[model samples]
Target: MDLTGKVAIVTGSGRGLGLAYARELAAAGAKVVVNDVDAATAEAAAKEITDAGGTAVAEVAAVGRTEAAEALVARAVDEFGRLDVLVTNAGVLRDKVLWKMSDDDFDTVIDVHLRGTFTCARAAVRRMREQGEGGRLILIGSPAGQRGNFGQTNYSAAKAGIVGFARTWAMELERANITVNAVIPVAATAMTETIPALKPYVDALRAGEPMPPFARTALAFGTPEDAAGLVAFLASDAASGVTGQAIGIGGDRLSLWSHPQQVVAAYADGGWRPGAIAEAWPTTVGAQLQTVGENLPEPPAA
Candidate 1:
């Protein structure tokens, strides 16, 4: 659908990847609602879009709260008279292994990433259904959701939930002409920068060292604009036939099949266990360690 007269609400648009999406959508002629927890940041983002000759407005709201989600959606429809696109991109990271992860950490991540998506999508879907004009819901997910990562149990679970939520919503919204899809992106953003364990691996890769064999088929890093392009396409009518699917956008690596494909068979209750870990044996564990050792470059000595 042409966004010339449409409106879009992009959560977390105050900065980073969300900002990229907001800018792109606005440039495409959509009246963009830039939502962020920080009022100043949201205002700045909206101003940037306006400066670039695009229509935009700033809203400060905690997307994780249902009321805030509803208010944000209402603001879009109230200000622009209609809402056409809902991009649920707000996310936070609280990395910790299951053993060491606190209950709060797990709850916070799930609440913001998964529950926040639920709240926003729910509100938007209701409005879209009422208007009978259909709509687009683009969810931002991560590779961690596809393949479990160490020291990121909370994050992985939250991201995985987004994938499942999108797939289900796609089916429910199909008959209504509303399309739901997941945009799996791999950009170097604030979240990645805070991952200490990933630093060594990233540094090694930058130094020309080959990545691990089980590196989950990582795509080369791309600028935020690259991800924005994919989001724009997915939000457009060009992808009308594409629904209930997960489209991944990673530099040159579009397909991510680098994880142990048989992880499910090794699990007992659809969850990881110590015994299951033993069964992985020489194949999974060995492959991972070998890859890390082979690819990890030593730091410069003082």
Candidate 2:
């Protein structure tokens, strides 16, 4: 996991998972650019790294904006000479059911989580191509994205879109030796605190106590530091062959998620008509249609 001489830009690095990623990268010897919308927090994170004898610089920018995304990459190159890793971790949550979710809520979440990752990756890829040294593009994803959440249509869609970006970009940049991957982290962070069921676990983490059984088994809740370790590995040279993967990190568990595939394909001599499809679907594709939220148990007695 030696990242000596490598330069990395981690968006939304002022706190939580992003900050953890930045710190880990810096600790691994990468010159990190800590980008956040909040100027003070970004500066504080950078100072923390520098004070610990690691190289870092703070960049305050809204990552959803193309100019800001470009500027972040530029700052990394200007300050560190070359960029090697780009972790698009900047995001915001706007949770609501489909009917209650407003246009603003949906648009803002998509812009920050989906478009923001695109813009930053676009900027970084340009520089990476020019340098011809290849690089790592690590995007953050969530379980809500993989398996739809009850009241997070916007967040789920945006996170799922990021996985698409990783898969597509992995192929597009493979020739250049740049790897693209997504990490779906389940951790006790500010974001997870929004879930009522996770409050006890988050509180326990804050108080340095053992996690609740439900939290440990169901969410597999861990700290941001646990997720950071995975990101650091992805950024390292050892992970050169691992790309387009949706990796899960929580507590001491790490998982490799399966990509979508045609489980059952039905063919006919002639193109199947609607009637034919109707008859075949039930026996074939329909039978395999998995249940959603199967992993979640019914609510405990109140």
1-302 in candidate 2: lDDT tens per residue? 79999999999999999999999999999999999899999999999999999999999999898999999998998998999999999999888889998999999999999999999999999999999999999999998889878888888888889999999999999999999999999889888988777767788899999765655556667888978999999999999999999999987679998897777777888788999989999898788887654165434566
lDDT of 1 by residue, 66-148 (tens): 99899998899889998999999998888876788898998888888999999999999999999998899999988778766
Residue 14, candidate 1: Cα error in Å is 0.7
Winning model by TM-score = 2
TM-score of 1: 0.79
Whole-model lDDT values for every prediction:
0.80, 0.90
RMSD from true fold, candidate 2: 2.2
Model 1 residue 182 lDDT score: 86
Which clashing pairs does model 1 show? 1-237
What clash pairs does model 2 have?
Answer: none
TM-score for each model: 0.79, 0.93
RMSD of model 1, in Å? 6.7
